[model samples]
Target: MTRIVVLGGTGYAGRHIVAEAVSRGHEVVAVSRSVPTDQVIGAEYVQGSALDVAPLAETLTAADAVVSALSPRGDMTDRALEALTNVAELLSGTSTRLGVVGGAGGSLIAPGGPRLFDQGFPEEYKHEAQVGIDSLAMLETTDSGLDWFFVHPAEVFGPWAEGERTGHYRDGGDVLVRDDEGKSYISGADFAVAVVDEIEQGNHHRERFTVGY
Candidate 1:
């Protein structure tokens, strides 16, 4: 089984990812600034900050994949990109795959046209969205030997709309995934499923993909 390291493990997206990975019998290490009251049974939670990667060197060395579920918010608003960049640098030229959970804003509205961020996006979320875009750009320029993948979840993905796990989702390459009604959404658990699937399948190397119903 894969040994997975989740940087923002205590967060919403990170927790789901840790749970999904553990449920699949993969070795998972959840790293965060604080510990959670509830924990995933089979996963190991480490109290640490992603901003400082030097201390996490040993913990990250043997990982088969390192997933960055970090969101640019609160104290991390300005440093999220730095943390991810450091992680990318650490995994460069290594066998460890870097998987990033990006925002919907970076996704294209069409095949090769406007992006969701170019349209009227909420002002409050602009910073976080830009971080996602920048993170993908950073990955694109990394060492060719560094295998990686960026995932943009549905427009409505978050704790607010935490739906049940259906064990199914669609892969929208570069474009946003929406239903017939033009609604872009996916449950947290299902998104985690897509992530683990990618980790195991290694389908899209060094590229970005969107996930939704």
Candidate 2:
């Protein structure tokens, strides 16, 4: 079983990915600033923040893969690029792969259209969205050659939707995913499925992909 480390594993998206990884019989290590009241049965939880880099690097060395499931919030909205750059540097030359839980705002609405962040998105969410966009930009241009993937969710994604685990989702490039109903959504549980599938299958290397119904 692959030993996987998830930074921000107690958060909304991270918990689901942890659950999915454990269900697949992989060794899961979850690191977060605070402990979760409820823990996954087979996962190991570590209480720590990424802001403390030395200890975080120790966890990276022991993992076969690492998923940065962090969102841009509070001070993190400004510091995400630094945090992610550290991750890229830490994983450089190691076999451990990196996967980022990305925001849809950086994704294009069409093949050659403007990104969601540039299309007059809600004002309140702009800062956090810009962080994700910047993180993606940084990863794409970084000189370090690390195996990584930035997986973005659909426009409607969160715990509120909580859709069922169909174990199925359509994958797309930089563009967002949509259906005939013009509703693009994916439950956290199923998003985890896609994440684990990517971790195991190793498809779409060094690029961004999205998952939705």
Candidate 3:
């Protein structure tokens, strides 16, 4: 079984990813500051912060891959990028692959066009959005010696969507994934499916990809 470590494993998207990965019989270690309300069976939960990676060195070093399901919230605001940098450095010489969750704001609004952030995303979400964008920027510009993959979800995604598991998804490059009707949406459950699939397949290496219905 693949030994997977999920950072921020109790957050909105992180929790779903942990559940999905565990369901697939992967050995999962969920790292979060607090435990989840409903923990998945057969998964290990560790209480810690990604901000401090020194103590987590062993956990990260031994993992087959690390998923940055981290979302900037509360004190985490404006700190995701920093945390990501530390993680990349910790896994620099290791064989662990890094999978970072991306936001729709960083994705292109169209093919070879401006990004969603450039078009003026809602002010309320700008800070959190920029954190995701900055994390991707670091991945693209720096040579941290870490094999990284950034996965962007649809514009409308999260636990609130409460969508069904169609067990089907479409993957694309930096461009946002939309249906024929031009609707951009995906359920959190489906996003987890895409994430775990990529981890197992090792596709889209060192690239940013988006997934949606």
Question: Using TM-score as the measure, which candidate wins?
Answer: 1
lDDT of 2: 0.87
Q: How far off is residue 76 in model 1, in Å?
A: 0.7
Specify the highest-lDDT model's number: 1
Kindly list the per-residue Cα lDDT of model 2 for residues 22-98, writing each as its tens digit: 99999999998888889999999998766666878888877888999987786676777788788888787788889
Question: By lDDT, is 1 or 3 better?
Answer: 1
Give the Å shift of residue 50 in candidate 3.
Answer: 1.4
Off by over 4 Å in 3: none
Q: Quote each prediction's TM-score.
A: 0.98, 0.95, 0.96
What TM-score, to 2 decimals, does candidate 1 have? 0.98
Q: Specify the poorest-scoring 10-residue window by lDDT in model 3.
A: 137-146
Candidate 2's clash total is 0
Q: Residue by residue across 93-212, what tens digits does model 1's lDDT show?
A: 889999999999999989995999999999989989999999999999997989999999999999999999999999999999999999999999999999999999999999999999
Q: After superposition, how far is residue 197 of candidate 3 from its true place, in Å?
A: 0.5
Worst 10 residues of 1 by lDDT: 53-62
Flag regions of model 1 displaced more than 4 Å: none
List, residue by residue over 1-213, the lDDT tens digit for candidate 3: 999999999887888889899999999999998887688888899988879999999999999999998888888877878888889888876789999998999999889978888887899989888889889888887575778899999989976787988888999788999999998898988999999999999988789999998
lDDT of model number 1? 0.94
